[model samples]
Target: MAGVGLMVLLLTGCGTLQRGVDMARGAVFGPKGVRPAPEEVAASPYAQLLIEDDAVSAVMLLGNDDDGRTAWFTDQHVVFLCEGDLVCGTHGLSARLDDMRIVGPNPFVDLRAIGQAPFTVDRRYDWHDGYRYGVQVTGTVRRVGEEEVEILERKRTLVRYEEQLSGGVDGKNIYWIDPATGQLRKSRQLVAPGHYAEIEILKPYRRRVQ
Candidate 1:
C-alpha cells in the first residue's frame, strides 16, 4: 500500500479530493501511459474505478457490515458504497447514484446460482443530478448469461446482468460477475440519465484477519 500513501499525498496537496484525483490522472499515473501489470495490481488490495472513462485507483475501507456491504474511497474523499460488488451509493461524481435498494432477492449476492438465463429482481434507487435530490426510480434486473472477458491480461468467464430502470431515471445498469468468487470484475451502471459509472476491479478488496 505504499503507492496508496503517495496517491493520498497528491490528493492532499491539491485543493479538493475530486480535483486532486483529476489532476493526478495525468501527473501520478500518466508517466506509465498504460495500465499496470496484473502482478503489480495484485500486489496491493486496491480497486480501479472509472466514471465515464476517467480512471482512478481506490482503496477499500475495512468494514464489518452484516449485510456484506463494502466501502471504497479515492484520496479519502470520493466514496463508492457497494453491496457485494454492486454499487449502492456514490459521492463526488458529476452525477451520482445517491442511494439504491434492492427490493426483493438480491441477484448480485449469488452469481453462481441464478439457474438458467433471464432472471429478474426488483430494485429502487435515489439519484442526484446536477440539480437536486428526491429523484427516485425503480427497475428490474435480468440475467444475461456468461461472457468471456479479459482483465489486465487475464482471461475469465463472467456472468452478465442488466438493470432496466424507469419511473424517474431511464438507463441500464450492466455487470460482469465472476461466478467463482461472486465478485464483479466489471460494471457499467447508470448513475443518472446521461451519466453513468464504469468500474473495473483491477485488484479485489480482501479483508486481512485482524
Candidate 2:
C-alpha cells in the first residue's frame, strides 16, 4: 500500500512538471513554428482613392457625430466615405475651386474670375434610403476677409470666402482657405436643399510613401 501511494505522488508531480515545460516553450517559441495564416485584406474604394503622388488622404467627422470617416482629395476632386459603407464624391465643388483665379500673397479668389454673372452647378448624390436625386445651386463667390478658425484643434488665421447660392436651393456657404498653399482648411457646404455639412481638415496634403 505504501509503495503504491509513493508511485501515484511521483506520477502526479511529473505531470505538473510536463505542463510547466509546455507553457514555457509556448511562451518562448509559440507552438514550434506554427504560425497563423495572414488575414486577407478587403478592397475598399476609399483606399483606391489614395493614389501615390496624385491625392492625399484625410479624415473628418460628419455633422456633430463622433465617428470619423476617411476622405481623399486631389487638386481636381474630393471623395468622402459616408456611414462607413458608402462613398460620396462631389466634383462640382472641386470645379468651383479650379475655376477661381487665386492670386496674390494672400491667395485670395477673384469672384469675378468665376464669371461676371452667377453660374449654376448641379450635383447628384445617393441618399441613405437608396434614392438618387439632383441638387442644383446657383452661386457666385466673394472674399469675406481674414478670420481666425480652428482646425483639428489648432487655431489658424485663414482667408475667408463666401458663396451666395440660389435656384433650387437658397443658402450661403463659407470656406477658410490657407493662403500659402491655397488649401481649404475648413468649410460649411450646402449638401442638399435645406441640408448642410461642416468639414474641417484633420490632416494636410502630403505624399504617401510607398
Candidate 3:
C-alpha cells in the first residue's frame, strides 16, 4: 500500500513538470516565428494618390462637432466661422483640403519633404526585454464626386505583451491632386475614431486654386 501511494505521487508530479516545460517552450518559440503577412498596397487607389502631385486651387470647407457644439472652418481662416447666428449651429456643413498634389514620397512619413507614391504602407516593429510588437498603417487615394483625394487608416497589435490588447483607428485625409503639374496638393486630416478619439474629415480638397 505504501509503495502504490508513492508511485501515484510521482506520476502526478511528472505530469505537472511536463506542462510547465510545454508552456515555457511556447512562450519562447511562438512569437519569434510568427510574422504577419505583408499587405498589398497596389490594389487600392488610395495608394496611388500618395505619390503624385496636383496643382489646382479650390475652396475647402471643414466641419467638426464636439459635445454638441459644431464648427465650420477652412484653411483661409483658422477661427471656425459660425454657420448660424444662434451662438453656433450649422446644418449640412462640410469642409475640404484644397489645392494639393501628390509630389514625391508619402507626406505622412515626413512633414518636411514632399514625397510621392501610388500608395503608402507604414509599419512598425519593436522588440525589447522579452516583448515584441507590430503595427500596420496604410493610406490610399479616393474620389468624391469630382474631387480626387487620399484616405488613411492605422492598426496595431501587441503580440508578445502580457495580455493581448489589439486595437485599430480610422481616419479621413484628403490630398488635392493635379493632372499634369508636379506641385503638391494641399493635405488635410479630418476627424474620425482611433485610439479612443472621435474625429471626422468634414470636407477635403473642395476648392480649386488659380
- Compared with the true structure, the alpha-carbon lDDT of candidate 1 equals 0.58
State the TM-score for model 2. 0.42
Query: Against the true structure, candidate 2 has what lDDT?
Result: 0.39
The lowest-lDDT stretch of 10 consecutive residues in candidate 2 is 94-103
Q: Write one digit per residue (lDDT tens) for candidate 1, span 1-210.
A: 454455455334322333334333322132212555767656643344433333433333322232345444543334444565666766555566766766667777665566665556566667645544555566566778889987788888998878777766678888888877877788887755776667667666664445
How does candidate 3 score on lDDT? 0.25
Model 1 CA deviation exceeding 4 Å by range: 1-34, 45-67, 130-136, 207-210
Q: Over all chains combined, what TM-score does candidate 3 have?
A: 0.21
Q: Per-residue alpha-carbon lDDT of model 3 for 67-133, expressed as tens digits?
A: 2222322222211221110111111113212111223343332222333323343323222313433
lDDT of every predicted structure (CA atoms): 0.58, 0.39, 0.25
TM-score for each predicted model, relative to the true structure: 0.67, 0.42, 0.21
Error of 1 at 41 (Å): 1.3
Q: On a 0 to 100 scale, what is the lDDT of residue 196 in model 3?
A: 14
Q: What is the C-alpha RMSD of each candidate to the true structure, in Å?
A: 6.9, 22.8, 25.4
Residue-wise lDDT of candidate 2 within 1-210, one digit each (tens)? Answer: 343343234323323212222221222111322222212112211222111111222222121111323333332233343322122433223212111111222212222233234433333333332233344445556676789986434578897878776764578767677766666656766554455545554433332335
